[model samples]
Target: MSEHRILKLFFFACLGVFVLHFTMTLLHNTPEKYLTPRMESYSHLWCYPTFHQGWALFAPEPQSKHKRMEMRYYGPSGWSEWYRAEHICMDQHIRYRVTHYSKLCHVTQNTVYHLWMAVDHFDQQDRPAEQFYPQNMGYGIAMVLAENYAHHFLPEMEVHTLQIRLILEDPFELQDPEVIHFPTKTLMDGPE
Candidate 1:
């Protein structure tokens, strides 16, 4: 075969591989445990770059309320007063620390939301939160928050125990806000 023909054949072969990889990725629904190591690696290499995983950025789920993080640290006597992990900026100056922490909370919240959706879809048919959500999800986010809390706020305070509360607020309602507390042991245990 001529050199030009050989090059054309090679190009077509590469194109074919790319198409196959992309198609498999787009349609991939198999759980990781079933995939061989090589197959898993191949999927990671090809699929991750091509796919942008997330819900619609412009249109999110309907939110009647907003949630914020509140934390209390271990103190000499007992737990310190609960304070907002997120900063409240009254000044005009941009608070980058606040912005960064807020973004972390946002990401963690979204991660938990996605995990909840998956659990809801699969296992919640018969039994709901009692069966699966707590055991399977939110540990990663909890660890991230705990470590960040220690590193950022209570480095000198020797924070042995941390309690984080998710405070949900409704703008329209005058009623008391809802507060959900994460387990202190889970926060201290670090990521699994």
Candidate 2:
């Protein structure tokens, strides 16, 4: 093939890959209910984290409430003072401005968000919120993350158990801040 023809073929190939990738990405980001089974299976296998995309930037229902996470650890000396995860994570981000700092923020925020959603789902189903813990992915991950955060920040203290609290502050609504207290999770066997 001539040099120009080779270059033209390469450009077309690149464009085809780009279009195919994004089309799959778009399909993947869509809700499973809206996608056919074949498409859903294709997207699930192909578009996990590596090719996945988030739609938070174009959020149709923007989050108006500011969520905060706090935790207290129970040890030999009794419960420690409540430590704010947001403050610690934000401080790290402000000082370092690195991916890890931002990820810390995600970990804290995701725990609160997922737990809140889990509780809401249980409520909607007319099930006791307490019952959700056994099968709740959010509860499982939260326990692990909460324990990790406790260890990271309070290395000297032996944390026997910890409880996480989620505070929802809506400045836009001017409503009283709502607080949800999660059950105290034992760290005896480590995270569930």
User: Who wins the lDDT comparison?
Assistant: 2
Clash pairs detected, candidate 2: none
Which residues of candidate 1, in runs, are more than 4 Å off?
1-61, 88-134, 186-192
lDDT of 1 by residue, 43-111 (tens): 665654445322334446545556666667674456768766444221211456545555655655664
By TM-score, the best candidate is: 2
For all candidates, what are the clash counts? 0, 0
- Give the TM-score of each candidate: 0.45, 0.60
Local error of candidate 2 at residue 104 (angstroms): 1.4
Each model's Cα RMSD:
16.6, 14.0
- Per residue, candidate 2 scores C-alpha lDDT tens digits across 1-192 of 899999999999999989978888898889888999899777766665353232245556666667777888888888888888778778878888855888888778887788777667666786565666647887777778778887886799888888877788873445999988877788774442
What are the lDDT scores of the predictions, listed in order?
0.57, 0.76
Error of 1 at 82 (Å): 1.4
